[model samples]
Target chain A: MTQDAPRNDRPRAVNGHAPDVFKREGQVPMREYPKNAPVDFVIVGAGCGGSVLAAKLAEAGMSVVLFDAGPFFQPRRDFASDEREQEKLYWLDPRISDGDDPIELGANNSGRAVGGSSVHFQMVSLRFRPEWFKARSKLGYGRDWPVDWREMWRYYDEVEEALKISGPIRYPWGPDRGRYPYREHEVNEAGLVLARGAEALGVDWAPTPLCTVSAPSGKSPPCAYRGMCKIGCSINAKQSMLITYVPRAIKAGAEVRDLAMVGRIETGADGRATGVSYYRDGKWRFQKAENVVAAGYSIETPRLLLNSSTAQHPQGLGNADGLVGRNLMVHANDAVWGEFDEEIRWYKGPPSMATCEHWNYADDDPSKNFDGGYSFMSQGPLPGDFAGTLTSSTGMFGDDLLEAMGRYNRMAGLKMVGESMPQVDNRVTLADETDELGLPRAKVTHSFCDNDRRLQGHGRKFMSRMMRAAGGKNLFETQSTAHLMGGCPMGDDPETSVTDDMGRVWNVDNLWICDGSLMPTGGGVNPAMTILANAARIADRIIDARFD
Target chain B: MSQPFRTPYPGYDVLDKWDSPSFDDQTREVLRARRDPPPRRFLDPNQFALLEALCAVVIPQRRPEPVPIAPFIDAALHAGRGTGTRFATMPPERDAWLRGLEAIDAEARAAFDGRGFCELVRPKQARLLRSIDRGDCRAPEAWQEMPPQKFFRALLLKQIVQIYYSAPAAMSEIGYGGPASPRGYVRLKVGQIDPWEAPFGTWEDQA
Candidate 1:
């Protein structure tokens, strides 16, 4: 931020209008909204879920206003294109961490800007398998979704189509035996290196199925593989909500006000949803809307619901059972590094090039030491990544550090996406610390269970053996967590779950949630694609049932 | 442009062989500092000299140039850059740094013929470091009271190496292209190299 901070202050004026503009391709679109405008639907957070709902509702001829605390991210115009300046994208206000296995949080956990985490993710969009829906029945530990994957298959199809997702002709172990919209990405150098390991272990591996466009489709363009996927994508390659849903919503006459932080969900005397009270530019503004949707992802969603406690529902909005912030889950992730004999420049393409889902068939094999299974994905950090974090993690610093760094090109790694058990203790509560806006921060407490240890231990040994078989030496492991889920789960029981089958918050008539927070179980894969699909399905329901 | 690095490993050309970089200004600054680092603002001249010696022995570079490592650490410390959270095992960065420096000098004087750490040759420096690493430091009263072994390995050695390798010169020596942001790599297929990538060896290199 010190060197290449974005100059959002100097917005390009358009047609003698004010600097409030959405520069699409080249054309600058602008409009002025009255302070007290009539709003039919108000969606909180302008990330993947919120942005998708906004686009869908606005397209169906409804007056919608989407709110986000972060500034609009115009990659081509504002991005520094450097990883050092990547921290500007993450939501790093203040979040607590407590776990037996140490996982770094700052830039890795959540993204703060317009498109939210989608704008700064690796974009490995794996759909939830049919068995994943009935996790509670199968695992005998977690909770099951009220509606199964059969009910939401069409929405998944629609999202894959809309996003132009590219993949192999078949995902042998995919959900609903679904085919990808486009061709899979070509196996990059990292994938090739991982292939050697996979072949040695007799494992099946393929190019990772990603929502990121592999070729030009409609308004979306193919990925150039900048290797900064976990950072903000500078080119219009990665199909985040910023380029896809957010812009579409704007085109459909939705007002997206940036830097507008929502304070509380305003409710009437009869416990009916009215509008939202938010802080924007040193003022508390209220926009009256019939329906209010909270799509602020996992951390903020629970925080918002708990913080918006009315006198009627004293615990919080839809917190009658006091189960708003519980069952916090993340992929029990581990990164294993392999120093090879040959050169492998991993910084060029996508870091996560391919995945081996051999161990992820959780339904068939229930006799495992771990409750759930794990998958292996490529982990390709750049030179700066090595010099900063990896080398420190390797425990070889100073002169030994230079020697280890000398093997930078030869070094390749893989992240083990092991499933984590959702413990009641692993929860997010309101911390005593309040932000500048007097809103309480999400106090997080997470720990690995015995199953987590077994999963990671088995995975670490398995990955190391594969690496060695691939003629790799000096194998090392760094413990990490990715794709956080749960907190506000969706189920039939209002006493246990926050939302119902349709992602509607229990006991609240016009309140809805369509984000990772609604996930009952953190599947063995990434949760973003499922979040998108769930949002689409909920948006459809909202469109059908126009409020009375 | 500078001549390519005569790297120790084969199967891949040195990263410096590339004519241009796709990274932004901050990356350029990081690379530039590796060769001609700015003056230290945190550590005094004595501490700076000691750190330079520590860095040299820690990551012994045989380059034609004096590989810059310690200056970045000095700059980072001067800027009061914490690593998000402090280690429960270690003291504050600046205080720990000073203690570690004095302890290193004490060990050097005790081992060598009354010579400070920086005064010793590279081999002698390595020997002194190994002693500190093994928690064998019997230091003077001037040295801060701390766990010698943990301090050396965790903070002193790890932090410095991280700073050193974060530069372009260090990465180029090992064939790294750093951060590719605006101009992303397109040739992602296996066994195919992008036009801008380092010339890698065939399947023969895999063996």
Candidate 2:
């Protein structure tokens, strides 16, 4: 079991020496490893799953070498108390575009930091709907997983405990609810409005299960409810991979090499994974290991595999099934804005203090034409973002329009997030273009089908009605492309999926994948919980295999 | 004269309240030459004058205040570069497209002679803005192809909304604390939440 370090503990220099004289302040230290140093395991991508797996495997007496392409983010040191400083840290890569287009196609703003995308996302944790695992059987659209939800429940419980997740046990508005494990906070206005609106429409609305630290569960502090949850939390109240798993992994004797880009995975003639080849500080390095795990996100993992071509598997490593880069999924999101007569003061609390899980599960009701559900975002925009979004919507110009904006600070908004079924066409491939690093950046090509459009339309209508019921005027709906699932899918059939029950690639032994890419179907709720659960499950399997 | 004035400061013309120098040719030239105009950039003097007239009509300077319209316009045009080639060249193109706009403005001024856009009798400025929004150019397609309606939308949104929101007064109007305050808050939240929002449950839960 991991114990919390003293509150004032300073980060120990690697290899038990003083801080490197050559290293810049706040820069991740570089280490020279002997060529082909043998390790028990090599975990690629130091995000959530890779960090967890590294820690777990290391704790089990294995020498783990973890690599991430981004720098190791020293939160307190690298971040500032000011919000603008924070935006600069998060959005400094000028190469990352910000328009409503794909990054490969020149859209800005996706996380490319040490902790990967997690370093820049809104912390919304949710478990996969049980049906998500068996979506192929129920939805008749995708392949079913080799393992059922029950097999992953133990890992889910373990992850929740490890992460110190605290929430009411009985899910609000859930069927057959049990006693809550912890006290739940009162719903915020946005959540309350959504609940009331859903009730008025005779739709079920319940408290959203979030991973936020509302009250002290372990060493983490309780949430102050500042409503700025989307930004990096200065108080460590919001859990991120950098704070939670990566630290624990480092403490447990795992060596993390940030800014180490893995170029290819090396396998033996027998088709078992041996190690990985990577680039760091202008040199090629190979680390041999008994096992190799790819925990890079959906886009990177498949790209890595496809890029790693070998004589034994020329199409790609573990590409015998030709399912390496197929079946991508992303949620369809619609936002609705409602101008209120009274000030809402939305910037004072978490970006999402409350969400309605009322429509998380598919309904067979005759009145509802779609099978997907929606989650309601309670917190509206922060002042600047709100101003930007609001002004963009309306054709407001000049100082006069600016003066008009000051009058309506308290307007509220809602976002409706719906799950999209997996489709082979929605994919992330290597773009014709390459990045400064010479790696082919991920080219994402995605569009919604008629079913997705129908779901969004229905969801928008329902959300608009709810806003009106909540005493809001000038209700306007905004559309957004989702940034959720795809790349790697899990199943028993090697012909259709990349990984097996434990996220182990079907064709390659000791090569596991644990990230959003493994999700077979995108659920309406956030995927953080499921990702952690799946990572934990994979770790357990690795432990049971006695790879250490 | 007996009608109740809608404004809080009746007869208080803030337009006459400023002491700053009016936008002059040198200032305009300096602002115009800031960046090498994108290929085929087209904002000429007459078109620029027309754009200024249109902006003044839409958001007239208020009284008893230092409302710097030129600075605002300069900033808006500078910031609007590369938003698209069409928008970047709008100031120059305004002269080429001046005839139709002049006709429209004449009609608008006729409808409400001395009253500003806000003070105008209903539907006058609205009618003009609607025409501009709709790309209602009377010129032949040969002379100057009215830029696409989409280009106008981008220009309007960029200049009117994006540039306006970036200004300090405009920020105050919307209660925006600039990107420094609330954007930072959202960034912090995103940092905390983004990683945790990954498929993994939470940072601590990952193992």
Candidate 3:
């Protein structure tokens, strides 16, 4: 029930990590500048996709400048193993949530750190099912991927290899002939408990393929099973872009300017993205680059694009179609936890290590009243994303709730995330509110559809059964949202979508999007691996593009 | 090395200082407030007393030592903290808390033979709470306009539950591990228990 002072509620300052090898201060340093040179690429947002784009482009010898709105969190010093302390990594941007069911705008929406939400992701790295690519074709709803799974399968493989995804040696459930680069980490006690319960109920459960390392590699070590993955993993076990792609990109000579909020994408009368104006160090600054990659997550990506309106492209960059902030999609996530007689001690390993895809709606489960289906993720049976849930659901409280905390270790929890329909009405727009930075805060408008509620209702019935089989009692359930997608959807039709399959914004040739912003649909799974895969694919296209 | 270790890591560490953080200031302060609460900054003396008595009835923890729910609630209200969402009929947290505290006492006085809420016995206090929860106490201005159930759910019940859990002492009674840094959990497989985790009677039976 504690609504903390929003990040911008004060003139915020966090100390630089003492043991940090990177020369950074107050999210400062690592700048490739006399502040004069026009880099070859200026990528906004240093998150899942931008980190990869910067690294790959820099590796290809493109001079890249990356900008992030929030401070850089140094892993060793900044990342606390405790979830309570590590919540500083969340973005506190001015945001408003409104809908039939308002999405958690505080924590789970998107991250604002230098590494973006990647720094705090739970390391759930499931690829989008190949059937999901054909969702529009096979299922009669949502837009389909212009390119099929076969076209992007190699990119998924490459991204996994680069991220060092550890999974079962033989993944029978892969879309393509996919093999994980590393062996699966051992499933924790909670997973085993859930697996037994799921088995009793005829459900398919497996060790969730995690991007977290299973074995030590360089500074990034194997997960200590600290169960601190969501809090930005300590000991560098979780491969957030901070330790993975951002550092690699920086090592490959991409300059990262943290706490540099990109205000607008500067375009010329020729309608080509020329550069960007940003706010840094209490003043306004401009950085020009040959190419611009707006990967500031879904909301910020479109916000910047919509704010970049000029006389030539007056409706925002490629907004002649009025699709800049249209079609926001977050998973219609729901959960059911049962109080078990045995102390599961759910908070031991990764917070979520087991998933059940029995109800994947991509092929269209006729049993479901809705078109899309849901995948189940096992939680601490404790609440939230402890903190992500903090920002997500606002905490549940009561006499029963107080008693529940006493038995927090005894609850077996499961989360169901199903495909959310991309409704244009559920969108992000410039709110009437603005931060001290004088920038319009993202006015997020999201409402769960009938399809979402129907899918969640279906998942709840099975989740209850699995819990009962696991020797649980007093089943409690609450529905929530996870894995936000589809703000700036990519497609062949520029009128309906924001970017091409290559993530190029229509009307602006050099301006590209390489983040969750480009996703057309949320594919009934965690979107991180798909985002990374699509970014790799987009970066490949960028590398091969013959620019005039 | 990957195996789990117990908390309070037998560490040979330094003394309490301004710079050295054993726990963040906010956490440290909250823990401190749980133990030796600061004087009421938001609620007046009467409001504070009523809240403490109400908390005792709501949570009922008076065995060895009491879990002080009033102080934590006071701090949050003073800081203007809330659940971030509320019933439209209810006012902002600061005003809601002020009026809610006043209304509860008013209800107790009206229902319990002209005695203040804190003056009443535990059973009497419980009766008044049940009455308010059921929207039977309609005299108090705050309860008059809005449904008492709404007030109890959004403010009163939510606050008490939050304050109770915020206390490490309450958490420890339930065999909860204190939030300790540099202490990350390791043993996570089903039928597995790290030494740090609470041992339940059914552990072997479940296995």
Candidate 4:
């Protein structure tokens, strides 16, 4: 989609009457900063990470500027219930994806708007398994995160409380973090199928911890079980960064600029990040800041860094060790669909309401063929997405496609977020081609390892048994990947990682990479909550160092 | 159009909830736009005709009014709308569509005595499309930058399927509740149906 399409065509307050749904009350208007005057912190990408950073920094009384390439969509006015119209929420900028097993990079891994992919993310909020943070030491695989799980637990608790995550009172896996802020929601039929299968297979299944509110919060309503979680939620019930952190950032006096594409990080002769040069309002403008944070996620973050190569630093800002765009990871997100005799109209609640994280937590089990594991959930895909899955995932089309679609109500699905091993070769490099913005496009090269394939194969067999145990037949599997991570990884050693554990670039003193890009290894779960927790930790560290 | 397609929920019309709380005002606008699709903008006259024929084979519908798949796709391409990702091997969306249609037409002409894809019969078109889907591109020259099989899966069939399912008629055919906004589903357990939702059955009388 083009960057110029205005999202707010319909006014929220129509005829002096505010709609009961998506009530926008007590939202503080975002502050604006002068382009010439330097702000304390200029964060690129007002998404999950950027929004959190901006909120934390601004709340700490820093003059912050948050920028995003896409619109600041007010969901009540901008979003549509239709899938075709809602496709605008995705990062539709035509990034090149290539490898031995080429990844499909649109709706699954990217988003453009201020809220970013969280705007349309299925709200499967999960914590990293405590051992995954030290996978190298504990599990004998993958890179070890510099941050400890105990320290990360505080950040996760903060994020969970802030977002008001609705989850079980006592989570089965990991350390007990006490009760969730809100109670768990009712699991749908698709979730029941998963629960049934989990019961038969003797695996733990629980109503997933989700960012979508279960009880009514101030101004924002609770979830209405609309089943269109992958599209932008019209109601503010989804608790996206758009509604949660972005608003908090604004309220704390952060200037959130939408539709502003940051082109380069302006560095000075002193070897420090000075400000940022960006494209906004049909002209290239400079926003001077004391420090800059690249929270543009994996692809764009690395692309921006590589594009901002200076005379002093020829390779890139944080590419001293040449690890800026290296070690890109995407979870092996494949689905197994089956048909049953009974009507299993899966589209009733949030797509992933119930989940089984047994595989992810049971890493030491001798039955496991792979080093890492997966967490699969029952899926409630809308009709349009389901149809697309049928054609792309399976080669079902023509009369056969129509016949299969006729049995849409009878179908149930289980999709996995399996852990994939990170290789340096799987990376984001600058392509020869340029985008409409005249910036070098990011060419994401990714391929699954043997461990990844084994994990997926194991997941397929596990899901098949579950589906059959739930009396589902004619099962078929579809291969795909989701939740991108690790381009500018964070570690204790600068030579081994792009950024420090606190997300500071080793070479660039004032610059930071504060997003999922800092994630050294993506755990076997949805990465949103973990990303938020990482951002919170980074923000806290930045705040702590600010007074130093 | 005769009612030949067998659907479990026979009489469920999603459009019936158009005036209900199920659909919000923005959803109504989106549906209206789809119902009255924009004229073909990106595809040339030949390509447009070919796309229409190809879509017919892809999703052969027997409705009172078939969904205008080709026009919607052409409009999206004209507007440079994408899901924001593309295969490194393939050309851009517009180039892929043009090259794919051209290559498929070339295949049809080669297979059926120099007649283009639009001139071919339904069975012939289906056979040609199946070949393209299977990566057996006879017209290698026609597919310059884009792979035939990739164009079929990633672009052509994907767009067609997505567009078809976006229509209200397709929603009715599949027994989908149109748009749950102000009023959403409550009874989400097994064998429980919301009063507004379509009942489960394959009875012919309902159709």
Candidate 1: global Cα-lDDT?
0.72
DockQ, in order, for the candidates? 0.27, 0.09, 0.19, 0.63
What CAPRI grade goes to candidate 4? medium
Residues A1-548 of candidate 2: C-alpha lDDT, one tens digit per residue: 00111221232334432122112233333233344777878889877778778778877877888787656555534443223224422322112122222222101123444455566556665566666677668755455666677776666677766665545556654333343334554455655666666678776655555555667755456665545555555455566776677766666767777667788898888978788988776677789887888888766788888878788888887677676767766676677877665545455445565566666663665656766565666654544445445544454444434444544444567786677767777776565545445666555556666767777887788778888988878687766544557678877777778888778888787788877788887777766777777887878887897854
Can you write out model 4's per-residue Cα lDDT over A1-548, one digit (the tens) per residue? 46425553222222222223344332334567887889999999977899999999999999998888877677886788888888778787888889998888877778888889999999899999999999999999999999999999999999999999999998888888899999999988888889999999998999999999999987678899998889888888999998888877877888877778899998999879989999876788899999999999999999999999988778988887788899999998888889877777888889988999999888667879998769999998888788888898665678778778887888899999999988999999999989877999999999888998999999998999999998888999988888899999999998889988899999788999899999999889999989999999999899998888
Tell me candidate 3's TM-score on chain B: 0.74
Error of 2 at A2 (Å): 38
For candidate 4 chain A, the 10 contiguous residues with the lowest summed lDDT are A9-18
Best by lDDT: 4
User: Taking the tens digit of each residue's C-alpha lDDT, what string does model 2 give over B51-153?
Assistant: 5565554454443542333344443333332221222222332332444344444445544554333445434565656555555633234224434333334
Residue B144 Cα positional deviation in candidate 2, in Å, after optimal superposition: 16
TM-scores, all candidates, are 0.82, 0.72, 0.82, 0.96
The top-ranked prediction according to TM-score is 4
* Residue-level error in angstroms, candidate 2, position A474: 0.6
The 10-residue segment of model 3 chain A with minimum total lDDT is A10-19
- Residue A542 CA error for candidate 4 (Å)? 1.1
Q: What's every prediction's RMSD, in angstroms?
A: 5.5, 11.8, 6.4, 3.0
lDDT for A66 (candidate 2): 78
> Least accurate stretch of 10 residues (summed lDDT) in model 2 chain A?
A1-10
Off by over 4 Å in 4: A1-28, B1-4, B203-207
Q: Report how far off residue B120 is in candidate 4 (Å).
A: 2.1
